[model samples]
Each structure stands twice: as structure tokens, then as C-alpha cells.
Target chain A: MKLKSTAALIGSIIGASLLAATPAHAQNVKIGLLSGITGPIAAMAPPMIAASQLAVAHVNEQGGIGKGGKLEVVVGDSACNPQNATDAATKAVNIDRAVGIVGPACSGAVLAAANSVAVPAGALLITASGTSPQITSINDKDLVFRTVPSDDYQGRALARTLKGRDITKVAVAFLNNDYGKGLAEAFKAEFESLGGTIAGYSGHEGSKASYRSDLAELAKGGADTLVIFDYGDGTGLTILRQALENNFFKTFIGADGMKSDAVIRELGADNLGTFFTSSPVGEASSSLESFNKAFTAAGQSPDAIFTTTSYDAAFLMALAIEKAGGDNAKLAESLRAVSSAPGEPIMAGEWAKAKKLIAEGKDIDYKGAAGDHEFDKNGDVPGTYAFFKVSGGTYESLGEMK
Target chain B: MELIGLANYAIFMGILIGIYALLALGLNIQWGLTGLFNAGIAGFFAVGAYASAIITSPHVAGRVGGFELPIVVGWMGAIVFAGLIAWPIGKVCLRFRSDYLAIATIGVAEIIRLVIKSEDWLTGSSRGITGIPRPFGELDYVASQLAYLGLVIAAVAVVYFLLERQLKSPWGRMMRAIRDNEAAAAAMGKQIEARRLQAFIFGAAVMGLAGALFVHFNRSITPEAIDPMIATFLIWIMLILGGSGNNRGAILGAIVIWLLWSVSEMITDRLPTDVALQAKYIRIFVVGLALQLVLRFRPEGILPEEQARQTAR
Candidate 1:
């Protein structure tokens, strides 16, 4: 009797799922908005999703996809882990029939989803926040791309900028995660190649009560400048506070992850006179201004982490879909055509103009709110960056880093 | 959706169910048959995944070998290595009672996770090892998925039949005796500690094989993939809700739970955008609710274990 009821229950669930799988409006083109909606980065996902939706809104408002087809997004919760990531990607590709997928957020999720589901199914993937250097090495058949720069580029850029400022020797303390480790390795390589000395280098696990012992060891190397590659609100704050109280390092450096207001709010800008951080920045352009105005009007903070990139990834997908004429096989090529150079510039929210250009068989280049998005051979962007210092309870950009 | 698309989705689900069914079977050997409460399924799963990944993946800098061996060798290595690691853990931890054993195993799993996260030379640290080749991966999408599904079904069948045979044997009776009453089993001269250790190691090996299949199917392995919520607790839920003591129940649990997990999103996607985004969290809640309802109403699970009756010969 129990087995019979259980069978009936399973049968109902399958039946309901089949009913749910029926196709929606035929004139709507679907794209997958895969994000870490429920896991480690849950706090950041809502704004990012809002930003992507904002892009879809711009597309539909401006004129939608080709031949009056409405651009629709199917959101999937990747949960910031590979198991859910792959499952979400599979459903997005096979069930929703999304021609392109915009994200899985975290680096590991991106790798798993792209390799297992998107790449195999010939769906184009553009991650907004997956920054690990390993992504550049995926055998993705040119179908995988990211709006955000890899940690490698930022690390190397920071190293070069620091050398330009005449700081040759530094002690590095990085959090032991993919983000911190990738940046540290890249920074170390670039700094050493430029004849700079890494007086001390160490990776520490996060959330420890005190890092004084680790600070003491790093101070023994005699480098006055301490470079941290971790989140400002987390271990990086603890490390900085300990180093300041102990007088372990005279000057400090941080990467993009460290450019947080939490550092200023916690450590106080008065004591951080010698602290500086390198962060990615959209080049001073009308593209960023337009996105900011539109996103703020949508009631979301334009400065939210990855919001711009998230917006850009979705907008680029829309353009690619338009260019590809809904053909899955040509999405990769269409993405490159719409986002790269040798075409008329299409700023964010100019979907109508871009759609007309594509329809007219004219080339178009997407100047994204995050960056120009002129993808290299590996579908990676050599991101623009700027060095910043804390001032008046906020970050003040010094100037662009070459 | 087109029939081909539905077929592809079903194939993908089947592959995942097969992998998870193996995990449930492994848990059954330890917790069901041997009456050991092992909460560190993620540790053994990670061990198998990384071992197979390091063995089969091509060589990369700053990490252990991509010996580039045959895929089968990698799968075998995963099983052997997972069992080997389980041996030491079971020896030290099996002495603890059920609850204590659970605590100890969770700690062990956390330790294993940290080691994998920190050890760059062996496991590539947090960036993880990629480029592990998938069998039949070169074929077109549908063909590749179909082939992999076939492979997974074969693996589950072999493991299922072997476990069934083992369950009906004298060893199975001894295990049941020890589980029901250790003192009584010992009075009958059963080796409780050694047999428990054997069960623990055997279960871990099966878990390792599942991990290998998972890593190969994904063509990559990352620390994120071994998250306790998905890799460990989810499998536990499947086993408990399916029927811990019944092998067929374990497979059914995998099928039902995974389908609910994957299908719930499709249903929710039909909602308005804001509601749909919020509705995603409901799927997680639904999973927990199903477990709660099952535990409340059907304590022995959907298919209760069959009693072995003594009849006239």
C-alpha cells in the first residue's frame, strides 16, 4: 500500500513537470540568467539579477529581438556550487531552450556548467563575475566568454602600477581562496618580472581571530609595504588592523577585492593614509553614465559589485541573439561580431539602434558599461583599471592604470 | 519543448540520478546494514573525485600528475583511494557511538575539504583541476549524453545486483544481527569491530566510484563541487526518504528527489519575474519540507525493508 502511494506521488510530480515544460509564446527568444542565487553569494545575486533584468527591459522596450520577438530571460539558481550549477545549466539549455546563458557567478560554477552543459550543448556562455585564470584555458570551442576581467589581468596591472609608483619590495599576505590566490600568483609573477622583490609571500585561511603571528613572520622579511589580496570586509580587515596596531608594515597595497567601504568604515581613513588599492574601472565614457542613470532609475545601486558587468553580459547576449538570427550554432561568432571592434559603436541601452544596424547588415560594436568589451582570442577582456585611495569616507580614484 | 530537448534533459537527469543512487547505496552499506552513522560522505566523494581527476587529467603546472592514464584506471584508482582513506578513519572513528561518530566524521570531512582547498601541489587548490577528458565527449550533444547515460545505467545495475546478492548472504545476516544487538551478535562470536570497519571501507569505495563518474561527466573537479549541502546532506536525504534498508528504495529516492529539485525550478519559472526569483528559494524549502513530511508520516520510508522470515524447509 505504501509503495503504491509513493508510485502515485512520483507519477504526479513527473506529470506536473511535463505540463510545466510546454512551450511558451513562439515569438519570444529565451536567454538563461544563471546566477548563484541561493548560496555563498546570495547577498550579491539580487542586484546582479536586477541589472540583467534591466538589460532585458531595455531590449524589450527598445524593440525586442528580431522580427518583433520579445527577449525573455529564464533565471536559474546555480547556488554557487558545481552540482546545482550543472543542473541549472542543463535545464536552461534543454528545457527552456535558452540560446545563450549569462552567468553562473562563481569561478568553479562557471567551469563546471560551461564544460558539462553549455559547451556540450553548443550554448554560448558569458559570465559576469567568474574571474579565475583557469577559465581562459577551458577547451570551450570559442563559446565561453566573460564580461569581467580575469584575476590574472588585475594582479599583473596592480603589480605594474605599484612598480610605476617606485615600490619595488613588498610582503604579500593573501587569503587562501581562488580569488586571493589567483591574484597573488599573478601579482607575484608580474612584480618579479619587473625586477621587484617580493620580500615575503604567504597565504592565510580566513576568519582567524588574530594574524599577529603571521604579521610578525612577514615583517621579518623587512619589506615595509604589505599587499593584501582578499575581501576588505573579511580577513583582510583583521590582517590590516593587526598590522597597523603592530606597526608591521609602513605602507599597504590591495587588489580589487580589497576596495571596499568596509575597510574605510572599520579601520578609519585617518590611519589608512598610506593604504592604496587597484580596482577595475570602466573608462570615463558616456556608456557608463548612461548605464548609471538607467540603473539608478530602476532603483538599484549602479555601484553594486558586478552590476555593470551583469548588465553588459545580458545586453551583449541580446545583441548576439539579434545578430545570430536565433541560430545556436552562430552565437559565438555573433557575439564576437557584435562586441568587438571594426564596427559602429553601440552604447548600453541603445538596443533599438543596434537592432536596426544588425537588420541592415551593418557591423556593430558594443561599448559595455563595464568596459569596451573588445574580446581577445580567448574571449577575455584586458580590463581597464584605476588605483584608488580612501578619502572622505569613500574611495577616490587617483588615475587610470596603463 | 521539442521531444529531443526533453530526451536530452531526461538523459542528463538519469546520469545524475545514477551517480547519486551509488552514493545512497554506499550510505546504506555503512548506516543501514552496519548501523554506523557516517556524516562525512563528502570527504570520501572528494577523495574519489580528486584522485580520478589527478590521474586522468593532462599535466598542468604547480599540481600533481595528469598522468593521462586510461579513464578506467582513473575510476579504479578513485575506488581504491577512497577505500584506503576510509580504512584509517573507520579504524579510529568506529569506536565512537552513533552520535559521536557523526560528529567525528563531520570534522574529518571539513579537514579533507580544507586540505583540498589549501594544497596547491596536489589538488590545484581553489582554482581546481580541469581538462579531465570525458568518455564519448567528442560526439555531438545528444549522442554524447545518450552514451554517457548508457554507461551510468550499466554501472548502477552492476553495483545494485552485487549489493543485492551481498544482502541475501550470510554476511548480511551477521550484519543485521550485529546492528540489532551488538552484545548478542558478539555472544554468537561475530567480529563486530572488524566487520563494521569492512562495511565502512566498502561503502566509501562505492562512494568514490560515484565521485569518479561525476568528475568525468563534468570533465572537471573543484572544491565547490564537494559542498557539504549538495554532496553530503542531499545524499543523506535521498537515502532516508527513499528507504535506508532497501536498495531499490535508495535508487527511487535519488530519482524522486533529483526530479523534484530540477523540475521545481521549471514550475517556478512560470511565475512573474520578481516572484520567480524569490520562488527559487522555495525549491530548497520544498526539499526540506519533503524530508520532514517523509520522516513524520513514513518513518521507515516509501519502501520498508522486508523481514527475513524463518519458514519450514
Candidate 2:
């Protein structure tokens, strides 16, 4: 008797979910906005979602999708883990019938969602912040793409920028996680290949109180510059503080992970005169400027970590959907056609113009807010990066990295 | 098209439910039948996942595997490796009373997670292992999903029937006796330590198999997938809610909890866009609330253990 009642309740819940799965407006073109809205990177998710929503708003406000159809977005919380990510992706693909999916944010989430749901279902996936080099090797059949450059690109670019500035020798300390390890390895390879010397290189676990011993060990190599590849708000702060207090290194360098406002807030801008970091920036500044203005007007900070890439991903998804004419099978090809070169250039937020161009059967190239997203064969972007230094309580760009 | 989509979604949910059911059944063996509090399900799960992934995946340049064995061999490897890893942990920590065992197991799980996160060559570190082969992965999306679901259901049925048979035998009665009163069982000439160790290893090996199933289904394994919250605590909730000592109840609990966790998002997605995003957070709260209500009202669980004498009658 008890079991019967429980079964009835489960039946009703499943039934209700089925009822809710039906689309309200059948003509509306749906897209899935998958993000880590509730887990490890919860704080970063809201802005990224908002940025994607902004792109949808631009599409709907300016003629929407094909044949007077509205562009609709179904937001799914990936929760920054594979369990939630695959679940979310399944629902987005099967229930919402999204033509394309914008993100699952984290690298691990991206892999699981793409492999288990999106790729198998033949749905297009464009993640904004999945930066793992491993993603470059997914036998995806051209269905998986990301707006953010892989960590490999940034590390190599930073290495080149450092070498260009005549920094011949340096010591490195990295956090023992995927982000830090990936950047450190790529930087080591590029820097060494460029005939630069890495005097000392070590990876440390995060949140240790004192790195004085590790710093001393690194300083034993007698290098002045120390390149740190960890989050600025995390153990990187501790390492930087210890290095400065002991005068272990005269110069300090960081990857994008270390370019946090928390560092300046805690360590003070005055003390960071010799500190420098390299971060991905828009190749064409106008594209970034337009996104910044629109995002700011929408009451969101355009400078939030992956906001630019998030916008680009959503906008590019919209362009592809338009180009494909709602045919799900052609989204992958359409995405490449719309994002790659050999056509009229489309800037961020110029949805109506791109739509018109697509209608006229002309090819279009999207100059994204994060970079010109000319996807390589692996659907990976070789991102444009800029060097920055702390000045006047904020980071000021020192020019584009070669 | 709509019906087909629903079928696809249902198949996906069914596959996940089957995986969680296996985990819950494994938990039932330890906590229900054997009176152990092994809080580190994620550790065993990770061991199983990485073991299977390495055994079956094509050799990468850096990692410690190029075995490229058959899928069945990978599953067998997962079971063996998980049991092998559990033997030492159980020998060391099974002596602790329930809560202490829980604490020790939690620490063990954390250590395992950190190792998987940091060890690059062994488990691909945080980048994770991809390119795992699925049994029917080359089929069309619907056919492949249906085939995987069928595979999962078959595995569940096999585990379920085996567990049911084991729980009905003399060994099952002895385990229950030891669980209800350790002192009395020890007085009766039962080797309490060895029995508990055996149950722990058995439960962990089952969890490891579930991990293998999960990795192959998803075609990838990451440290994130082995997070204690989802991989460990979620299984515990299913076992406790389904009635820890009841194998059928364990399966039921997995179905109930997973449906609630997943379907709640779909229901909430119908709300206005802004509220829908905030409502996503409520799904966690809803799961927590269900557990609390169950604990307060149905502490013995939805399908409480049937008394042995009553069952015999």
C-alpha cells in the first residue's frame, strides 16, 4: 500500500516534467545557455549568463531568428560538475530542443556534456570558459567549440612577450591544479624553446600559510623574476607577499589567473610596481568596446572574467542558427561559416546586419568581443593577448603580445 | 518529435538512475547489512573510474596506460582495483565506531580526490581522461542511448538479484546479527573484524563497478565527477531514504531522488526567466528538505527492514 502511493507520486512528477517539456511557442528558435550557476564557480556564472542573455536580447530586438521567429534561451545550471553537466545538457538537447548550447563553463563539465549529450545528439556546443588543452583532442566531429583560448595559447604568448622584453632567466611557482599546471607546462616549453632559462620551477598546493621555505628553495637558483601561475585571490597572493617581503625576486610575472582585483586590494597598487600579467583581449578593440558599452548599459560589469567570451559564444550561436535556417544538422558547418573569414565582417551586437547578410546568402565573419573567432581545425581559438601592469590602483595595458 | 524527445530524455534519466541504484545498493551492503559507516564512496568510485579508463583507453604519451584492453576486462579491472584499494582502508579504519569511521572515510576520500587532481600521469590530473569507448556509442543518438540504458538495467538486475540471494542466506543472517549487536555476535564465535572487512571490500567493489559504468556511459572521467557531494553523499541519501537494509528500497530511493533532482529543474524552467535562474538554486534546497522530512517522519525509511522472524513466517 505504501509503495503504491510512492509510485503514484513519482509518476505524477515525471508526468509534470513531460508536460513542461513542450515548447510554448513552436516557431521560436531555442538555444541552451548552460553555465555553472550553483557550484564551484557560482559567482562567475551570473555575469556569463547575463552576457549570453544580452546576445539573445540583441537577436530578439533586431528581427529575432528566421521568418519572424523569436530567439529563445533555456538556461540550465551545470553546477560545475559532470553529474549536473550531463544531466543539464540532456534536458537542454532533448527537452528544450536547443539548436546550439553556449556553455557548461568549467573544463571538466564541458567534456562530459559534449561527449555524453551534445556530440551524440549532434547539437552544437560553444563553451565560453573551458580552457583545457585536453579539449583540443576530443574526437568531436566538429561539434565542440569554445570561445576562450586554451591555456596553451596564453602561456605561449606570455612566454614570447617576456622573451621580447629581454627577460632571459626566471623562476616559476605554480598551484598544483589543471589551470596552473597547464600554463606552467606550456610556458616552460615555449620559454625554453625561445632559448630562455628557467632557473627554478616548482608546483605547490594551494592555501598553505607560508611558502618561505619554497621561496628560499626557488631563490637558490639565483633568478630575479618569478612567474606565478595561480589565482591572485588564492595562494598566489601568499607567494607574492612572501617573495616581496624577503626580496627573493626583483620582478614578478603572472598569467591571466593572477590578474585579479583582490591582489591589488590586498597588496596595494604601490607595492606592485614591478608586477606584470598577460591576459586575453579583443583583437579588434572596437568589438570589445561595443560589447563593454552594451553590457554596461544592461547593468553588468563587462570586465568580469569570461563575460566577453560568453557574449561572443552566444552571439556566434545566434549567427550560426540564422545561417543554418533552424536545421540542427547544419549548425556545425554554419557555425564555422559564420565565424570564419572570407566575408563581410560582423561586429558584436550587430545581429540585424548579420541576419540580413545571411538572408542575402552572403558569407559573414564575426569579429568577437574576446577575439576574432577563426576556429582552427580542432574548433580551438588562438586568442589575442595583451600585457598589463598595475598603475593608479588598476591594471593598464602595456600593448598587445606578439 | 515531442514524444521522441521525451523518450530520449526518459532513457537518459533511466541510465543515470541505474548507475545511482548500483551505488545505493553498494552502500546498503556496508551501512545496512554490515553496520559500517564508510563515508568515502567517492574514493572507491574514483579508483574504479580511473582504473577502467586507463585499462580501455588508447595509450597517451604521458599517462601510465596504453593497455587498450576489451571493455569487459576494463570492468573486471575496475572491480578488482576497487576491492584491492578498499582492503587496506577497511583493515585500518573499520575498527572505529560508526561516527569515527565516517570521519576517517571522509578524510580518505578527500586524499583520494586530491591525488587524482594532482597526479598528471596516472589519471590525467584535472584535465581528466577522455576517449573512453561506449558499447553502442556509434549508433544514432536515440539508439545509442537506448542501448546504454539497456546495458545499465541489465547490470542493475544482476547486482540486485545477487544481493537479494546473498541477503537471504545464512551469511546474511550472521551479518544482520553482527550489525544489530556486535558484542553478542562476537560472543557467538563469529570473527567480527574479518566479516566487516569482507563486507567493506564487497561494498567498495560494487561502488567501483558503478563508477566503471558511469565513465563508459559518459565516455570520460574527471576528478569533478568524483566530488563527494554528488558521488558520495547522494548515494547515502538514496540508501537511507530507500531503507538501508532493503535492496529493493535502495533502488526505489535512487529513482525517487534522481527524478526529484532532475525534474524539478524542468518544472522551474517554466517560470519567468529571472525567477527560473534563481529557482535552479532551489532544487538543492528541495533535495535537502526531502531528506529532512524523511529523517523526521520516516527515520526507518520508506521501506523499513522486514524482521527476519516475520519474513520466515
Window of ten residues with lowest summed lDDT in model 1 chain B: B304-313
- Candidate 2 segments whose C-alpha is farther than 4 A from its true place: A1-26, A204-221, A233-248, B308-313
Compared with the true structure, what per-residue lDDT tens digits does model 2 show for residues B136-255? 999989999999999999999999999989999988999999999999999999999999999999999999999999999989888889888899998998888888899988999999
Residue B124 accuracy (lDDT) in model 1: 96
Report the Cα lDDT for residue B114, model 2: 91
Q: What's candidate 1's i-RMS value? A: 3.8
What DockQ does each listed candidate score?
Answer: 0.48, 0.47
Local distance difference test, each candidate: 0.91, 0.92
lDDT per residue (tens digit) for residues A317-402 in model 2:
99988898857789999999999998999999999899999999999999999999999999999988999999999999999998
**lDDT tens readout by residue for model 1, A232-347:** 86789999999999999999999877887779989899999999998888763788899999999999877677888999999999999889886768999999999988899999
Each candidate's chain B TM-score? 0.97, 0.98
How well is each residue in B147-205 modelled by candidate 1, as lDDT tens digits? 99999999999999999999999999899889989999999999999999999999999
Clashing pairs in 1: none
TM-scores for all candidates: the values are 0.93, 0.94
Q: Quality of candidate 2's docking, in CAPRI categories?
A: acceptable
Fnat values, candidates in order: 0.76, 0.66
